[model samples]
Target: MKGIQSTGPALLMLAILILAPAFAEPAPNTIKIVCTTSVLMDPATYIGGDRVEAITIADPTLCPHLQGDIIPSRIQLNMDFIPGADLFMAYNDSNDQRYNIPAVNDFMKANNYGSVTWKTVSDPSREWNTPAKAKLLAEEVRGWLVQYDPINESYYDERYGEYVKSFDAIEPTPAEKEKLNQTQVIVMLWQREPVEEWLGMNVVNIFAPEFALNGTRTAAKVVDDINANPEKYRNVSFIIENMQSGELAKGIEESLKDKGINVKRVVFTNFPRSIEGVDTMAEVLEHNKQIVL
Candidate 1:
């Protein structure tokens, strides 16, 4: 009887041990991805599928480039999360949307957590703001996921195919392409340069904001250019603005319409419109297409 009682408890304990993992959250062997910016997290989530746990150094609520401005408190919080990451992906838009990672690296060093070798992407042929670039980056992300978790290679590729197809629908239609081909545009901000190529529009000039020109005579002289040669800027059907640089639009609106230029003054967000939306790249790109077209 004592043998039976002892064995009964042991068997029960054994059963509990075996069942514990079945009810556990997040299965073992899941890849941990740490993205330098939240904008990159969208694509990483899609490509990682359910096998990845993604952490973004930059949160979705902030602007893309502003990710570098995360406060000291947030940095300490990240110290708890980043040490376990298996892969680190960083975007290298040194000209337009640079990210600062030295602080993150230093934290890892202080905590004795090894610093991950970062994989970077600088889209030299096309900028990251457009759908085409998003599609290209998705492929790169898929490759990274596959490299780390080769067992789920097929799964990642399947998700990537769907992601690419979704963006394919966002491309300009034939008629829209023809219209864009004929129209010339002047974007007031340097960050908006990709819109010109993405929409097939001729970008005559991309004006960089000289902060010194705020309410200065130089600003007036530039405004005079739009007023004096309305015909020269007639084909300028879109005065696309950066969401970050609303000041550039200050006095240009009246001059742009001196000849009834009828331009669509559009604003573009550098980051995903909604971070929680799993298909953020598709949603943001499609939103831009609907507005621009």
Candidate 2:
């Protein structure tokens, strides 16, 4: 009788403990932030830590300008959380102005929800893939968090310092740089900065979308240039493609391979979660390095 009595109470206590979480309320003062892209979400997540709930609307794998069927579906799925969001953030670039913002607005309006008053976190149309930009983004996110929740300023500042420390650890070592410097690469226009300038690789040529700068060579044009002037890319061993920009270097890779030049192609994503297990800006940088190195 005594064993049964003691065991019954213990079992009840264990059950109550397990079920407590299911009935628990969210932490007080938890601010919900709606970010248009993972570029903003990644930093917000790291800097905000447990204090903020950050969410992204767009598919990081696709460019902001290209509104495929996925964007609409995502907005619909996130509609539940959209209404009570404390803050809305975006790049506010031409792409966001045209597609992302409108998609969000149209959805909100149709549902009778007011227009989103977005906080701009990035320069218009600027890329956020590089390490330098990533650091700047962390600062931007920290600043925004502090401004929004001044009471948690110290907490955000501490988290920002920790994030920057983690970022600094991923900086390529001199030996890694030497290896990168020895390799010749062909890269997408958006990926050129990280590959050539940051990684210290010898960039043989760059290919871009047809709508890029008037003088910039499109992928097809790059292939033509490569064939016309083989010497320029004779040593090119790798083609770095941008995931958001589509496979702009496919023709270039195929052409090089057809000409008996073996070149490896690697795609890099600017946003977290676009690649498996790459959930943060530092991991994104590390992921890019691991694939190429």
Whose lDDT is greatest here?
2
Encode model 2's per-residue lDDT on 1-293: one tens digit a residue: 99999999999999999999988985568789988889889888888988889779888878876755678898888988888888888888777777777888898889888877888866765567777887887888788889899987999999999988877888889999989999999888888888887788998888888888785689888889889988778788799988888877788998998888889999977778887888988888888887789
Clash pairs detected, candidate 1:
none
lDDT of 1 by residue, 1-293 (tens): 99999999999999999999888885557777877666678788877777777877765555445455563346677765678778888775552234446656777788788775887775634556777777878778888888878877898999889878887877788998897778777665544555666777787555545652363423355577776666778777766666644446545656777667776667655567443453477777666666666
**Per-model RMSD to reference:** 5.5, 5.5
Show model 1 residue runs off by greater than 4 Å: 1-26, 59-68, 71-73, 95-99, 122-126, 182-184, 189-193, 211-224, 244-247, 258-260, 274-279
Off by over 4 Å in 2: 1-27
Worst 10 residues of 1 by lDDT: 211-220
Measured with C-alpha atoms, the lDDT of residue 197 in candidate 2 is 73
Query: What lDDT does candidate 2 reach at residue 281?
Result: 82
Error at 98, model 2, angstroms = 1.2
> What lDDT does each candidate get?
0.68, 0.84
lDDT, residue 18, model 1: 98
